[model samples]
Target: MPAQDHRAPPMPVVRLVVSDASHAYLDAVQRQIEQALLK
Candidate 1:
């Protein structure tokens, strides 16, 4: 019998809505992800 792969693939889009004060935090997270991919 073949085994199944339980891991799920990453999603293409991650949508989020935040207050003005939280926008900077969200932008920082997005930048981190982008930088990690560049390395």
Candidate 2:
């Protein structure tokens, strides 16, 4: 359960990929992921 919780955030990236997001969007996502990891 804990492992799946950790893996969950990346799932949204599929949508981002399909949408062809820009670098700024990716950078924001990266920052959120980094903050999550810091917690």
The prediction achieving the highest lDDT against the true structure is 2
Which 10-residue window of candidate 1 scores lowest in summed lDDT?
6-15
- Over 1-39, each residue of candidate 1 has an lDDT whose tens digit, in order, gives 123332222222222333544888889999999999999
Candidate 2 residue lDDT tens string, 1-39: 999998998889877876676767888999999999999
Reference-based lDDT, each prediction: 0.60, 0.87
Poorly placed runs, candidate 2 (over 4 Å): 1-21
Worst-scoring 10-residue span by lDDT in model 2: 15-24
Residue 14 miss distance in model 1 (angstroms):
25
> Candidate 1: which stretches are off by over 4 Å?
1-18
- TM-score, one value per model: 0.47, 0.46
